[model samples]
Target: MTTLLEPVLSVRQVLTLERVLAGEPEVVAGAGQLDRPVRWVHVAEAADVGVMLSGGEMVLTTGVLLAGDDELQAEYIRSLHRAEAAAVVLGLGRAFPAPPDVMRRAAERCGLPMVVLHRPFPFAELTEEVQSRLVRRKFAAVSLSEAVRTALTGLITADAPLQRLLDEIAQHSGCPVVVTNLAHRVLATAGERPAVDDVLRDWERISRQAGRGEGDGWIRAELGGRGERWGGILLCGYRGDAATGRLLADRAAEALVLHRMLGGGSAHSWEEQSAQSLLTDLIGGVVPARQLLPRARAAGLPVNRRTFVPLVVRDGDPGRLDRILRLLGMPGLVAELTGRSTAVLLSLARDQDAEALAAHFAARLRTETAPGTVVAAADGRIAWDDVPAGLREAQHVAEAVADSAAVLDLPPVVRLRDVHLRGLIRLLRDDPQVQSFAERELHGLLREADEDLLSVLRTYLATGRNKSRTAQLHHVSRPALYRRLEAIRTRLGVDLDDFEQAASVHIALLAHDAQQR
Candidate 1:
């Protein structure tokens, strides 16, 4: 869960009434949310009760409802107020010279969404608008619970590969599927396979074009990226259901984050299984990342900050994640489980920056998911070959493997990519460059040599050119080490004697292998 339910904007809610009434915005304190559309108009023929309306509801009268006495004119205007109408419009030729001034003053007391119309508005449009809003509301409710169940299902068992998952999700949602970073870089894609690498590139275009006050299905939401994290959003969908998109997008975001989290985080077996099941089920079928956005809008809710970095939650009632999203901007905290028992999470306040986001996620995980539930956050922003950079991808590698392993031992969601490196190494070995380097440059070193080699190089470079101690620790005869040194020089094609070359080799070689491993 990555979002907190924001206060429903009353202005827009009122306009819903206006559009239904076929009324114009005569007056609105906060014009931003209103000034546009409404679905309900109070058409009352009673006394001028238009003043009673709260606002944004048009009052319709035929004057027949108050046709008789001059003394009762003021009473008629009062009725619009009773209906809480937006504005009162005297149907032309209905009453004598319109109700007395005394009645209009009373109508002015309350700021109503009253509008006078020269003609009777079509009521069919109102009905349709009301039905549309209702439909939206219904979907919103469905999406909320659906998000929870889906999160659990993603944690369930699955045999599909990453491409299959993306395909299914896109088919269901009727939109493109993309996995992005805080920088809006597309790490992977599902629907628009033809443009897989364009995810980030497109994000750049959409982010620049997004604007506020546009209440279309297409929207820009902020995901927390303060610190070393990825924050982004699903820009648009064909249906333009912003409300539905919020619910669906958050689930997808959580799934990705939890999927990433499981590689290194802690989660119980049951929790892990549930999350995978939902993810598999959701993506395995036709699923759209923005499926729930429309529903959110109908519920009179506002979605802020599209990028909700997910925290993976497992067996632990991933519902907590959904709840956390609702609580995020409210009380300043949120959390969830993406793939069932695989991972749990929390989203902090937007003002809280990167370090704060990470810190809050860690602290909240300790409070909710379990003590020490949050282990580490890996971001693609790190140097592609650096350990810190690979940490993020490694976690996902672990997740993909764990998802496969989930078919057995009740499965575990805490995936560590290194566990699968052996298989990958075998695959990459087909490349002669990789094979030769492993056989020659890294030869004589144990299987675990890669890990220590990087560490040793890092430390060795830190110590300057110190051969005697380097040989002593390598546990080698100094002369024998010298012979090996000459061998290293031959394979590496650089002089260890050159200060710059030594440092460069250490970083370039180790960092490169670390990423692949």
Candidate 2:
């Protein structure tokens, strides 16, 4: 059965020929064949009629030119096979009272469908009926294409989310719909009848092979407009005809591009805005956890039964982090918090420890980020309701460690508990009293003296007063380094050998740097 919205073709089978000719047509040879598309209905009386057909055409003839010579008839059938005709319908009576044996044997030998008209039938009637049906089907296909475009456009105007739009397309096409970035990360998915997880569980491999071949049962359409390509929309397990699958994928892509444009502002992509908004609101803490839970889940976080681990990374590529997350199949939200910082919220299984996960995450990012990059995470995992606090805590640690002597240790995961006194000083960096204390303690160093003394002081304090390392770092002799250190102590009115004075100087330096950042 063919619906008005389904693709149409003009291929005729032997069964269809019998039906069209009102049971007068009988399959005399190649009787068990009825499947394959027909191109057109053709009629010719010449001996070399096979040369006239392009392919897949049902040739209606009287066998007047193909009669008598068994060898000639066999050659004619072979020529039809070479030309790829659909079937041969021979009319009986005037040309031959009975079906010709030579043509019947030739048709069977060549495996060409041979149908004989046992009763008187006009060739014109058969041609007219088949041609009209083909025309109607072609027009129906056009109408269906337009209808899909209209439906998808209407959904776009409704401000439906990306997943909802994909769902509708899946319903129409009876397949799964997947939206992916150019890096092949599954951004959103819909229309998997069993479950979306089933489709996405192996998305990395599935997306790699998508649109390259038919064995994968996938089709793709480019998903961008305005002279820029964003990504692609994939149709998985599309059982419909190839033409209809293309139509469905293209319509879905158009709707997605339109949805992104309408939902996003001029400056940021819709995905980026969605990530930033959710993260910003989470840390802002005005909205209730229950209210925000739905949004988090909709954004693809497994928030219900999972632990929330908040992380902040500095000096790393946010794009590369995003791609790695997708490659590892980790469910998380990553967004740029500042030009030099990126914030992340990772969802881990209930049994997983946040410390271990943070270490792994930081280690992976360390290889890709610039040297001296700092990755700070919350001290421990928290429940979903406390995620905002967790995010703020990680952000505080990241701020505390950025450009500070603490990052010299390069711990895999810097935590609030790990930064010690420096973290506390950084946390209080904005206080008027703390700013005054730093300015007072380091006023002499801040004065126009050789800046090398300040560098030596910063490095010497960072390395726990290791004079040899400090000298080697500054490419100077031990006395030269000692001279710089003595100058720093004199400027700050502190003793390098006194632990209390050294600690005060360290805290002031940390506060000064945090405030600058």
Badly placed stretches (over 4 Å) of model 1 are 1-41, 44-152, 155-169, 177-179, 194-202, 211-216, 220-229, 264-517
Worst 10 residues of 1 by lDDT: 380-389
Query: Cα lDDT of model 2 overall?
Result: 0.74
Quote each prediction's TM-score: 0.34, 0.50
TM-score of 2: 0.50
Give per-candidate clash totals.
111, 1
Root mean square deviation (Cα) for candidate 2: 11.7
Candidate 2: which stretches are off by over 4 Å? 1-270, 380-382, 405-407, 447-452
Scanning candidate 2 in windows of ten residues, the lowest lDDT window is 1-10
How close to the true structure is residue 193 of candidate 2, measured as C-alpha lDDT?
36
- Estimate the TM-score for candidate 1: 0.34
